[model samples]
Target: MPSEIAPAGLRERKKEETRRLLLEGAAHLFKERGFEGTTVADIAAYANVSVRTFFRYFESKEALLLPDGVEIFAYVEHALSERPADEAPLDAVCNALLAAAKPFSASTLTALSHPLEDIENVITARLVQAFSDFEERLTVLVQRRLPPDTPDADLKAAVIACAALSAVRAVLRTRRARRASGISDTGPAPLLRAFGILHEIGSPERP
Candidate 1:
């Protein structure tokens, strides 16, 4: 007789396969038809799956493009928890931002190299959505990390989060401007400038 398989294990495996297929299909469709034009049914058809299966993995098309940001935020929170007690809150946040940006920056560069129209509706929109999701998460994470007696921890955290996001958007916008200007080698200057601005804002007692 064949061994009985666990229903939960099978369900999880099926979910993973469905997720992979949906993402792959969505990427292709977004590249081919532009993100705004690609419908859920189109993605489902491209993946050879039902429309319901597509919704099981992603709530909206914008999700497929930036699925990792939430996961990255969890990793960042974990990393922050391991920081030295003597480290300033801003310093800890800066470190986390740098680490988080490494992977995200690389992916954004790859996306930026693609046609502007392809990314405008798909990649950029997804990034904005991800940042919106991250803001609340970051606020909570910062509150937890700060001392219980700290005043206005949530507000300060919100400011820091906004500053960090602003930095990221500025960097990407600079890259877009460079491309628009027909300058091929804008180099790391734009990214460096973004970091500088973020650091200034994130520093304790911002000057």
Candidate 2:
């Protein structure tokens, strides 16, 4: 049994190492040739794997470049659920978004350091699509937090989730713009500011 388990574990590790090599190779080629310019063959050759092996791991070059949205979404959902029960609705969502953002930024999306302009555009478009997915899932999670008997509960959840997700998109867009302009600022400050604005919108009194 131990011998059988050892071989399986080694095989899994080798598969994971191959996947990582492909991602790292893709990142390097993307930086050198831009997203549109890079090809699957180029990545496979760089990783010293056959093109067929690359396909066994990733469906396309874009798949190699994009972060795993399902994994990130799960992370956000778990983080939101684990927040203190007494925490404010907005604050809970904010914390979850921030927690997810750190790993998101550290993923393949930013591994290129500074992706070319075209590559950045592709990433920005993909993220915008992901925002919609996050909003849909978050609405359900936010709804769970509200009293079941609350009036317009579904609408309230949808609005809150949408607003919170827009903040995530806002932060990404702002950072991308700043990076394009050669102004480097990578932190949670932008996200915090976006949520602060949301808080003011729901304030009881307007100045």
Candidate 2 accuracy as TM-score: 0.72
lDDT of 1 by residue, 66-116 (tens): 665666767667777777766766667666766655555454443433323
Measured with C-alpha atoms, the lDDT of residue 114 in candidate 2 is: 32
Shift in Å, residue 49, candidate 1: 6.5
Q: What TM-score would you give candidate 1 relative to the actual structure?
A: 0.61
Candidate 2 local lDDT, 72-125, one digit each (tens): 788889999999887877788889877876776532334332333345478656
lDDT top scorer? 2
Q: Supply the global lDDT for candidate 2.
A: 0.76
**TM-score for each prediction?**
0.61, 0.72
Q: Give me the displacement of residue 130 in model 1, in angstroms.
A: 3.2
